[model samples]
Each structure stands twice: as structure tokens, then as C-alpha cells.
Target: MRGDVLVVHETEKPPESWAAAVLLTEHPDPSADAPPWQEEAIRLLRDRWAGPGRLVVFAGGRRGFPSAAPEHAEGWASDWRGTALAHSDVVICRSPGGGCPAGVAGWGAGHDSGRIVLRVPARPAAGERPEPGGPEVADAVTAALAHLGTGAERTGVQRQVPLPIWRTDSFQRWYGAQRAAGNTLLAARPVWSLRIGADRRLVFYWALHAVVHVTAEDRVKDNEVVISRPDIATAVLYVPGATIDDTEIVLVREFRTAASTPDGFVHELPGGSSMRTTDPRSLVACEVREETGLHLDPGRFRAHGSRQLTAPMSAHHAHLFSAEITPEELEVIRGLADVPQGVAAESERTWPEIATFRRIRTERLVDWATLGLIVQALTDRGHPLP
Candidate 1:
């Protein structure tokens, strides 16, 4: 992995400055009674910083001087002096407890400083463990070099693609034209559907479930649509006393891949697309039961209201509802688990264990998913806004 280097400045140079590099290399055959710290330090350097460097081992009273053979010590160097030396624009000294001489003669060789000494904790601590890869060490080095004014910082930008929408009639016409044109525009045929609204507005949503390869100047090419504006529906469920505590709400966390969204894990409320049912209240109940094992009665939960979100490239109409649920109901919902089946079988063959469950307080309800719907339901019932 690529990373930056760190440089340190010192006012005065110590006696020994001739060593080009000081590396921690493992002993050919370390004794069982060897000091644990020495062994650990050598291990850390070898495992984490094995890239483009040489190893140097100091001699001890009993161990004598390290066997710096011609092949091993040809390009390697070390100082027995305790004095500080400058390398790669940074100062370094022999660590404490080594058998090297106190001060020794060394030259200021023009050497590139590509190595760093890391202080590792002697014992393991809570929430702390040895890093698995060298990238982490590279990151640390880069950060240190940046702080020392010897490294440059990098910047990156991400773009999101917007979903497309059209009228049902216009979409059908476009689909027929493309089909008659020998389907040359798209690699695979596009799937078109009619999304009708209660207000008599017919929206045509095209979903190309199959992948399509398009040759265009713009990098942001449109992918197949999984959910259309008309097919997209949202419902909010409310429990009267649920918000009393600060950690009651249980939001589902999953990985979602949609236009204008990250491909990482996301937290969302239980909801579905293309709801054919007329009763929004019943839809909320069914969704809650299906996604989260919580059985909610339609009569107990009432539709607060509906909101329509429209942008230049995407539109979604959501229906929000609220219902009261007991602590026992919350427990059941938290415990209910399922292993993904069918197409998702390989992805989640083993059921995911619940990571955590918390009841959120009324004042903190804003942190929960579908906060707008929850607020709407509460406000409709004369609940004062926070």
C-alpha cells in the first residue's frame, strides 16, 4: 500500500549519525529465555514494516554482537552510541536496555529515511489488538509525516447517479419505439410498467433488471431501476409508550444498493415497494410483521399522513402510521431472526445475530429512521413537539 513518510527535526546532532538505517530483525534462533519485549518489538517491525528496509540487531552482553555477516550487513548499518542521529529529516536514538556502546563514531551518510519506530504496548488492553495488515502502519507513517510537514495530504470526491422517471404513456411509447428500432439502444430489453396514482396521475416506471452496457461520454450511466417513484411507498409504525425511553426504537440495518446512495450498510425502517393494497394502515401492519416479527393491529395503529418527495431525478411517496406496542412486543421483535433464503441464500446462509437493541426516548426520536412519520403521528395526537 502507498503511504506518506514522517520527518522529525532536532536542534543538535548526537555523537552517532553514521548508521543509514536501524531495523529490528528476528534472531536466527532466539532462545526460550530471551526478553519478551525485544522479541515483540522485532516481530512488530518484521510483520508490519517489512517493505523496503533493512534489519539491524544490536549485540547484548550475553548474546554478544549480532552476526552482521557480509550478505546481511552489506547495506545495513547500526550505531553502538546512545547519541541521537538525523535520518530522512527525523531524529532517532538507540532504545533503552540495549547492549550497544554509549557513544560511537558514525558518518552522516545521505540516506533516505523510510522507516519509523512504533511504540507498542507491552500488554493487551480492552478494545485493542495487534493490527492485521501493514496498511495500518503505512497510514500511521503518512499521518506522522503530514504532521511533521514532510508529507502531502490527498483528497477524493464521490458522485451519485440520479434515477430517471417518466409518464406511463410516454414510457410506453418510448419502449415501443426502442423495440421497433431493433433494440439497438440498450444491450438488454427494458422492463416497463404503469404506476397509477389515486389522483388519476399515471406515471410510467421503467425497470431494466438486467445489466446493460452503454457507451456514453458521461460516466454516470443509468442502471436498471429496482423501485420506481410510483411503486415506492413508505409506512411508519408508532407505539404510544415506545418513545418514553431513550433506546426503544429498533431500526433494521442492511446493505442497500440504489441510485444516489452508498453501497455500504444502511439503517431503514420496515417498508416495501409497489404496495397494491388501498389501506395504508394495513400495509404498515403487514410490513412491520414481515420485516420485524412484530404483529401490529391495524386498529391500534392509524395512518398519520402521507408525504411526497420529488427531486429532479427521483420521486417517492411515503405513507406514515403509528401504533402502541408493549415492552414484551419489543422483545419479541428483537429476538425474531431469519436467515436470508432463495437468491440471498449464499449471502446470508447463517442467521445474523442481533447486535444490539435500545429504546429511544421521545426527545431523541429524531435519531430514529422515519422520524417525519413518527413526528406527524405524534403531532396529530396533540403531542407537543420537542
Candidate 2:
């Protein structure tokens, strides 16, 4: 639950300035009953900020903060929802123009008004104590730590591990951050932790569920809850050079702020979660273009494979595909820097924050699990591997 520690000064420094007057949160409608945690979170936030800026709070809309602030407090609006959540927060920057800093770490970004709106991540309290041992939960937690690699359970901010071309640093940082936050209700591979429950019942972000069965007697049999995600579309696209062995991968490298990494961008397949549950095949075309500007005919993609990720803690499945990148498309992707996922404003984008980094070598750092699938796709298609 970290933030940028925004300090607005009225031509001078004051002890009470950091205390925000208005606590802003999202609501589909202003009249809807507020979330149960809203009031409690505000109370906690007030204590942390420590100044009686304003007693009144509002719960709706994100873009109206300028008009909503009181005259006494000309600039007093910030989002502090992370404090109530169990996980540590990471920073994200939004870029609308060719050069916007809204998305870089340790840097301020400019908005349309040429003003910087910095939303910095809050660093988690380091060295959280180990959980009390329970035979069942302890066993599960131990196994998860092993799969996640060393220092995953170590406190006081674990050091960064060298990212494989197959993995993103964001995931690694997130894993450590989750452990630092110490909310390990359910743990397993793929999904080291379950942030939210089924249909978002337990939390408001991720979907966690269990295999359930209802018998004729009306008695229910419930299995452990696991993570669920929108149907995903995965593709291992590559451009074939003049020589048969000159195949270069069509990959994307993007910064994921959730990992709290300045350089955690990973070599990833050009894919994304579904916008709908229908044929995921339709997603490849849009995702590839938005992610890397690599246009592809979805119809040309062949079904490479599918697999369940994090079998124990998640029912999340990824549908994998393989397609050949045309020479014209490769030219477009080859000339670019990485994309960074930023604010709520640009998050709804098809490519959100992604950049093209087509692969000429497997030696480039990659996200392992994803790279494994990509290699499989190539192997199935008889594409030569280095």
C-alpha cells in the first residue's frame, strides 16, 4: 500500500498539507450504496495522513476531482484505496503524447495540461513474520515457496533475480510483494496467491473459485478455491527470413508496474485476456496490432495448443496459437522501444501499454513458462530453434 507521498505546498511547507481533504473512490453511480470497506479505509487513511483536512468523503467518479475540491484546499484529491487492500501497490504511468512521463519510475509525467500527475507506488513494510504453521496450509505454503525460487519468503525486500527471456520482472516483484504483504490465504503454483475470490466475492480484483458439485441429495461437495481469468489468447508469431533457418520471433516487451520494476519488461508472446467469452481467435488480430503494431490475419493462425496454468490454485486456461509473421509486419515491429502499462485512462486500450521487441535470438531474457509454450508451438510447426 505505497504511494508517491504527494506534498502540495501553498508557497511554503506545512505539517497539515499532506492530509487530503477529499478521499476519492469509484462507484458506477453516485447513489449506489458504498462498498463496505470504503469507510474503514478512509478512517485508516486519515490516521496515516494525520491532519483533519476534511471530514466529508465522496464515492464516485475519477475525473471530477478538480471541481470537487474545496476552495480552502485548492489541490486536495488522491486515490488511497491501496492502504485497505492487503497487497502492496506498484506505480503506473500513462502516455498520451509522444513523450509523456506518466509511466516511468522515479520520474514525473506530464498530462494534457502539461502538468505532472505522479501516482507513485507504496513500498510494503519489509520483514513480515512467517505465518503460524498449520499442517494443511503450511504444507501448501512451503511447496509454493519452492516453486517461486529462493528468497521468495525472505523479508526486507528481496533482491531482484535475473529475469529469463521467458519471464517478466513484474511477476517476480509481485510474488515477493505479495509475500511481503503477508496475505497468503491460499497458495499454489502459477497463482502463488489468490488475491480475490470467485466472481470477485472475497476481493474486488481477481476471480478465485473451487470445483463444486451438487448431488441429487442437494448436498454440495466443494473443492479448494482456485484463481480464474478471462479466456486468454496466446500466440507464438514469427517472421521467416530468406533462409529457412532465419526465423525471428514476433515478441512484445512491456513494463508491468505491478512488479515494482523499472527494467522488468519481459520477452512475451503477443496475447491478452478476452474482451468476451466468444472465439478467442478474434483477439489475436487486435492484440497483436495494439501490442506490437504487427497486423495479422486471425484466420491464418493455426491452433498450436492449450494448457491449464497453475493447476492447483487456478482454473485459468490459456489457448495457444502459432502464426507466421509476414515480411511487411516484421518491418513494423522491428523499429520500436518497449511499451509501459499505465493509468486507468489508457488501461482499457487494446494494447494498453506495450511495445514490439521481435526476437532474433532465444538468448534474450524471456518469461519462462510463456516461452516454454512458444517453443512448443514452434516445435509443433517444425520451426528450427536455436
Candidate 3:
């Protein structure tokens, strides 16, 4: 995103009451000493804001940058030396009175694009200060962009909750791939989008808003936002014994906040998102090993089928698979119940759970969907039970 920047001084008065503003094309010498506020502004300009757009500074009375005099003018001038306001697409400034000043509405009068006023704390300790280049500022800028319908094709209303900014490259790459595959409902442009949550290197949840062109004469506004996530790979590890009572299904017990169970833990098949591997079979095997600490070949995983977990809320599917194991392998997996498994860096922890097939099928210890997967895998493998 090409971001325009406006640096405003801390004023008790509102923005419209300001008498002068200055447009700066060149940054002041880095070696020159500056006051605290100027120092913070310079940091934001250098690290946070990106521009081929205008850089404007605003203040009241005679106050201005140390190197430049205030251009006493009405509203924002169209020109200051060689700099022009016409090139600006967005305006960004800090909230000097703890909240955005009401007069900021006047600043938006001349521009069709969005304006963002970063919030500041009402009272900070004598030495403590908020980081202008931190995640909070990034969130504010992205929210402003989404609300203003900034994207390849601005369509419909870009509805989105304030969320962490997706790394620009990541969002662009994903969007480009979707367009190339013609999977975005013949979208003309993005109305808005945001990443709801994510892992270290991947997004777990996402939302999008767009406009679709179904025909030459018809333009349909896509709903406010459509949410989705990456598909999951899951598998049931079956261990055979001499009788039905002895037979077991290997599962993992992990703390999932989304789980509605009593303990907020899910006791289900070993499965997870494709984080460590992109190959579906490999992902199944990888999740099994990470969650159960039981090594198994990817080739051992038999793909039964895949289905959408939630049709209305997400477009992602769950790829179902199963693996057969020897009784000795079951013992080895059982031994891992006391030992924590899963990717530690990602804050995951799981314990192996080996339950009798009969009990798991009748007791409702797991979700109905998981029970369905188990039954489907067993029946497909020619081990149908009564």
C-alpha cells in the first residue's frame, strides 16, 4: 500500500483552528538534534510511513519544523514549493488530545481517500511512551485502508473488524493466486479483507468483502464479509486386537478454546492445519507424529475423502484419512500419554489418548463428526463393525 503521511504537532486546540501547515519533500538531517516530539515524528516517518505521496506537517501559530517556516494558509494549500497535495491518497496523523480531534473531518474535505488518526494514551508515566511503529499503529493503518475499500477491485462495503495487519506480500500473493484460479466468484475488486488470527507463518482465519460481476448488466454486492480458513488434514489411527472390546483408536487431547466440552479440550483424531507440510498426506502424517509422538510413514495414511467442516462459515475442507497400526505400536503410543508432544514453538501441547472403539462410538467422548470419520475409515478399510 502506498501510504501518505501527515505529521501534526500536539495541540490542545482542534485541527481546523490551525493557522499554518508545511509540506516537506526532504527529511531533515538525521544527525541534527531534535526535541522529543520531533524525534518521535521522524521515527514514524522513517519506519512506519511509505510514500511517493505528499508529506505534510501541521501546527498552529508560528510553530513549524526547525528547518522550515510555517506557510500561514487556509485549510491545506494545494502547493508548497515543489510538493503537491494532489498526489496524496491517504492522510495519517497522531491524536494529540488523547483522541482524534473532531476537526479532522475538515482535513478529509478535500480528499476522497481515507484519513487515519492514531490514538494516544491519555496519561503516560513521566518516562514511558507508546511505540509509534508498533503493532497497534499497523492495525490502525490497515483498518483505515479496509474501511476505505482499498484493494485491486474496490467492491461492495469492505466490512471488517480491527485486526492485525497481514504482511503486504502475503496478502498480495494469496489474492493473486485466487484470481488466477478464478475462485473468487468472478470478483471485480476487493471491498475489504482482514486476517482474524494466525500462527507463526500462516493465517488460521480470514475474512473478505468484494463485488462480483456475474453479467455485463448485473453487479452484485458480495455480502459484508465471508470468513474462511485453510483446510485441515485429519486421520484416525486404528490398532487391532483379538476382540472388539480390546480394539482401540488413537487420538490426541489438546486444549482448544473453541471446544465446547466441559474442560475446553478436544479428544479427537490426530489432525491439524497444514503448517509443517503442504502435501495433504504428509500433513496428516506430520500432525500425527507431532501430536502423538508416533512415527508413521505418509504412505500408510489411506485417504477416505474430504468434506467441509462448516459450510456457511468457511470454505475450507477437512481431508479424512486412516492408518492401521500393530498392537505393539499402540503400546508405544500409549506410553506418550504422560509426555507432552506437538510443536513447542507454536504453543501446542497434546497427549496421546487410546480409547476402546466400542466406548468411543457409544459414549460421545468426541464430536459426532469425528465419530463419523472413524466409522467411514474403518468401513472403507473393510473392517466394518456392528
Q: Which candidate is the best by lDDT?
A: 3
C-alpha TM-scores of all predictions: 0.35, 0.40, 0.53
| Candidate 1 per-residue lDDT over residues 1-386, each given as its tens digit | 42211111122121221112232211222223324344333344334433232322331222322333222211123432212222222222223232222232332221111122332222334587633323433443333233223121211100001011222322334334444744423222224333344521233453433222333332323464433344333444433442332323445555555413343544455655432435666766665665666676778766656554332233345666666567677667656655331124223121212221222332232233356554565667665554
Give the worst 10-residue stretch by lDDT in candidate 3: 156-165
Candidate scoring better on TM-score of 1 and 3 = 3
Q: Which residue pairs collide, candidate 3?
A: 153-189, 153-190
Question: How should the candidates be ordered by TM-score, best one leading?
Answer: 3, 2, 1
Model 1 TM-score, 2 decimals: 0.35
* Candidate 2 TM-score to native: 0.40
Error of 2 at 342 (Å): 10
Ranking by lDDT, best first? 3, 2, 1
After superposition, the stretches of candidate 1 with alpha carbons farther than 4 Å from their true spots are 1-227, 231-233, 238-247, 259-263, 275-278, 310-313, 337-369
CA shift at 185, candidate 2, in angstroms? Answer: 18
Tens digits of per-residue lDDT, candidate 2, 1-386, equal 32212321122111221212222222212223333233333334333432223222333223222222232321222322221111112111212221324233222211221111222122223676422222322332233222222211212111111111002222433344444654332322121222232321121123222223333344443455444445567787776554434556766655565533336655567787642345768876666666766667889888865676555654456788888767666666665444432223545322222222234233545655676776677778775655
Residue 196 error, candidate 3, Å? 9.0
Q: What are the runs in model 2 whose C-alpha is more than 4 Å off?
A: 1-225, 241-246, 258-262, 336-364, 384-386
